[model samples]
Target: MKFYKRTETRKINIGGVIIGGGAPVAIQSMTNTNSRDWKATVRQIKQLEETGCEIVRISLPDMGSACNLGKIKKNIKIPLVADVHFDYRIALEAIKQGADKLRINPGNIGSKDKISILAKEAKKAHIPIRIGVNAGSLKKVHNFSDNFLRAKVLSSAAMEHVKILEKHSFQDIVVSLKASNIDITVKAYKIFASKRNYPLHLGITEAGSIFSGTIKSAAGLGIILYDGIGDTIRISLTANPVEEVKTAYSLLQSMELRNSGIEIVSCPTCSRCEVDLIKIVAEVEKKTSAIKNLKRLPKPVKVALMGCIINGPGEAKDADFGIAGGKNTGILFKNGRLIGNVNVDKWVEKIISMIKDYCR
Candidate 1:
C-alpha cells in the first residue's frame, strides 16, 4: 500500500525552497552554537548544509543575535529560521535583518497586540511563521489529565496561534506540536494534521542522547510519516546535530520514502560462519561516507555479505551483490549467482572496490 497520498494545499516558501502540496519532504536541523557569534553560527550552518540539511533554525535570544541574521543569511545557502520566545521585538528585528522564517509560540508572546505585530512583520517580509507548541510550554489552562487531553490542549493552542497569524492575512505558516512523551507527541500531531492544511514539522522534543534518542525519534517519526502526517522532519537529540540529520534520513529510508548515500546490508555471524562480517561492514561504511551525490539505485539494491552458504545464498538471493563464507575463502555472488572466490585476506579490499565500481 502507498504510505502517503499527496494533499492539495497552498505552498509556503522558506527562502527559495517551497514546501506543501506534493513537495519532497525537507530535512531540517537547529544550530546549537551562539547565534550572536556570526562566525560560529555561519560555520555550523555551512556544516549542516554540507550534510544535506535543507533548512536551519537558530535561536534569536536578544536584539544582538537578531541583528546577526543578515550576516548569517549572507553566508548560508539554505533558509534561515529565527526561533523567538516571548519577545515580539526580536521577531520584528529578525525579519528586518532578513530571516526567512519565524518560529514563535504565540501563547507565550505576551498579548494579542504583540502577536499581531509579530504576524504583521512576518507577513510584510513575506516570511512563513511556524507556531511551535511544546508540552513543556503549554498554556496554564490545560489540566494534564491524560495523554490525549494534553495533546488536545497543545493542538488547540497551536491552532489558536495559527488563527492569530491568519487574522493578519498571514497564510504562509507551519505548525509543530512537540512532546517528550512519544504517545502524546503522536496524538498531538495527528489531531493537528486532521484539522489543518498547514505543513507539519514532525519531531520528538528533548529525545535523549544518541542511542535512546535515535530509537525514540525513529519510532515516533516512523509511525507518523507512515500515516502521511509529516511534511518535514527533525530528529531532536542531545547529541551532535549531525546525528539528527543521519537519523532523519534513516527514518525516511525505513519508510522507503527516500534514500541517501550507501545503505549497507550485512548479516550476523553464527557458529556455521567464517570471515569477519562485522569488521567488513564497518570498514565499508567508513569508506563510502563521502559519496553523497549518487542517485538512488534504479531499484533497492541489497549488498549482502553473509557468513555461511547453507542459509546465506538463499537468504540473500534478492541482493544485487553478495558474499558467502567458505573455509578461509569468501565466494562473491551477483544476483544470487556465484561469480568467483577470493581469499579472506583480500575480501575487504575486493568488496570495497566492487562498491566503488557500482557507485561509479
Candidate 2:
C-alpha cells in the first residue's frame, strides 16, 4: 500500500519522545483528575502509561496544582505536559516544577513580556511549549459567516500566537488548531501546514463521549493524519482518559501507520450467527491486551472471530489464529487451516491459550 507523504516539520522533543520531522506520530491524553490530588492524578497517569500514552497533559488551574508538578513528574515515566491558560506565572511555575512541556495560548497570556518570560523559562527547562488554539476559543471563529472561512480564521489565530513565541526566539514549539467540527479542524490544520514548519498536536477539541467521540476523532484525525499533517494526536473524549489513548492507537493501526498490539478483525454478527460472538470477542480482547504495550511479541497477531461458517473460514484463514462457529461447536484454525472443533464454552480459553503461546 502506498503511504501518505508526511510533511517535513521541525522536530520537537516532548520529554524523550520526538514529534514531527517524519517521526512516528506520538499519542497523547490529558488527565481529568484534579491536578492537586496528587495520588489520584498519578494513578490515572500510570494507567495512561500502561495503555501506551507517550505524552500526558494535566490542567494547571491554580498555583496549588502547578506547585505539585515536580512530585507528579517524579512518579510518571512518560513526558508530563502542563495545560495552563490566561496566566503566565502558573506557566512559569509549571516549568520550574519540572513540566516536560507546556500547553498555553501565547495570545491569551496578557502581554508580550509575559510570553517572553514563559518562552525563556520553558527553553531554560529544556521543555517545549504547545500553542493550543481551539476554534471555540478563537477571537473570530464564529464571526465568520462561512464554515470554511472559520477554518481559515482558526489557522490564522494559531499562527499569530506562534509568532509571539518566535519573536522571543523560542522555536521549540508545537501548535494545534482544534474544533469539534471535523471539517473545520481538518481545514485549519491544512492551512497551517502550508504556512509553518512547526510540529502539530492534533485533536478534536471537546470531542464528546466515548461512543460518539471515537467516531468523530477517527474521522477527523484519520483524515488529517492521512494528509500526513499531524505530528502527535490525542483522541479527546469525555469518557475515561484511557479510552482516549486506546482510540488514538486504534486509528493509527487502522491507517496502517502503526502495527503495534493485537488487532482483532471480527465480523458484526448476522442472522446466520449462532454463537455468542460479542462476548467471546470482548473476552479475547480484554485478556490479550496485557501483551499489547510490551515488546514480547514479534509482531501483532491478527485474530478473527466470525459468527458463521460461510464467511468465517475465509476471514479466519488470514489471521494468525481464528475460530469459526458451527452449530454448538466452533472450528479452531491456525493460519487459515482448521485444527479442530471445540465446544462454544471453551472458545475464550482456547483463544487466550493461542495468544499466550504466540507471545512466548
Candidate 3:
C-alpha cells in the first residue's frame, strides 16, 4: 500500500507548489487552448484547478504565445509551466513572463552557448527546467539499431541534456522520458530513476481516446508509480484536457496516492439486477459531480451502488453508505448494516441528502 516507499528525489518548487522530496505526488494536465489566447487558456486552466489539477502546462509554439504567459498566469490559481521546444528564445520569453516552470530539452534548443544562456537566466529567476525526452525525437541523438537499447537510449539522452544544464550550474531540474508504448515508458523511467534522483514527470504519450487512453495510462502509470518512479503525472488523452485531469485523479485515487473526491463503488449491472441501476448510477454521478466542487466538505465520501446480493453488501461492506437495488425498491444500508428499504425512485436523492448532512 505504501507504493515502494516513495523514492526520495530532490525537491523543487514550481511556483509555490513543492514536488518530489517525499511531497504528495502532484497531478498535472496541459491546456489544449491556443496559447496566444490568454483569456481562453485562463478559462481552461481555471476548470483544471477546480477539478484538482495542481500544475498546468501550456505550449509556447512561438514568441507571441510565449508573451502571453504573464497574462494567463495572472488569472489562474495553479502554477503554470511553459512547454518549449527547439527555441531557446521562447524559453527565455516564457521565464520573463513569469512562467513557474519550463519544459525544454537543452540538447534540442541549440549549441552549448544557447543552453548556458537559458540556464543562467533560469537560475537567476529561481525557476526549474524540465529536460523532456520523447522516444520519437530521441532517435536524432542516438542510434535505434536495437530494440533492447530503447530504454537506455532514452535515459542517456535525458542525461545528456541534464549535463548541459549542469554545466551552467543549474540544478533545479525535472525530467520525463515518455513513449507511447507503456512498457517502453515504464522501462525508460525505471532506467532513469536507477541512475539519478531528479524528479520525474510520468505519462504514456499519445495514449489514444478517453476510453482506450484511460486504460493505457492506468496500466503504464500504475506499474511505474508502484515502483515509486514518478513524482508527478499527466494522463494524456485526446478528449478534453479536463477529462485528462479527471482520469489522472481516478488513477491516483486507485493507487491511494490522492483522495480528493467522492469514491463511487458500484457493481456492474448483472442478470440479477432488478432495477434501472445504470440510470441510478448515472444520476448519482451527475449529482455528486456538482456538489464535489463545493467549497466545504469534511472529506472524501465513498458511496456504493449495488444491484444484487451476490456481491452487493458483502463486497462493498465498508462503504460509508449505499443502496442495493431490487424490484421497484431499494435496500438502504450504512457500512453493510440494513437501515431500511425505500422506493427505488427516492434512493438517489435520499442517499445524497444523508451524505450532505453527514458531511456537514
Count of residue pairs whose backbone atoms collide, per candidate? 0, 1, 0
Off by over 4 Å in 3: 1-3, 140-147, 292-299
Off by over 4 Å in 2: 292-298
TM-score between model 1 and native: 0.93
CA shift of 211, model 2, Å: 0.6
Worst 10-residue lDDT window, candidate 2: 291-300
**Clashing residue pairs, candidate 1?**
none
Worst 10 residues of 3 by lDDT: 291-300
Alpha-carbon local distance difference test for all models: 0.82, 0.87, 0.86
Top candidate by TM-score: 2
Q: What tens-digit string does per-residue lDDT give for candidate 1 at 1-360?
A: 356764444678999888877676788999999998999999988888877788999998999999989999999899999999988899999999999999987567778788888888778788999999888887552576788988898898898878887888889999999988889998999898888899988899999999999999898888788777777889998977877887787678667666665555677788887777788777776766565544345534457878877877788887878788878888888887999987877777887777767876
Per-residue C-alpha lDDT of model 3 across residues 1-360, encoded as one tens digit per residue:
555678899999999999999987899999999999999999999999888889999999999999999999999889999999888899999999999999986446677788788889999999999988888776542466544478778888899878888888888999999888877788889888988899999999999999999999999999999987789999999999999988887788778777656788998888899988889888987887677543244456789998986678888888888988888888888977999997888989997887776666
Candidate 1, residue 234: how far the Cα is off, in Å: 0.3
Candidate 3 local Cα displacement, residue 51, angstroms: 1.2
- What's the distance in Å from true for residue 188, model 2? 0.3
Q: Candidate 3 has which clashing residue pairs, if any?
A: none
TM-scores for all candidates?
0.93, 0.96, 0.95
Off by over 4 Å in 1: 1-9, 139-142, 295-301
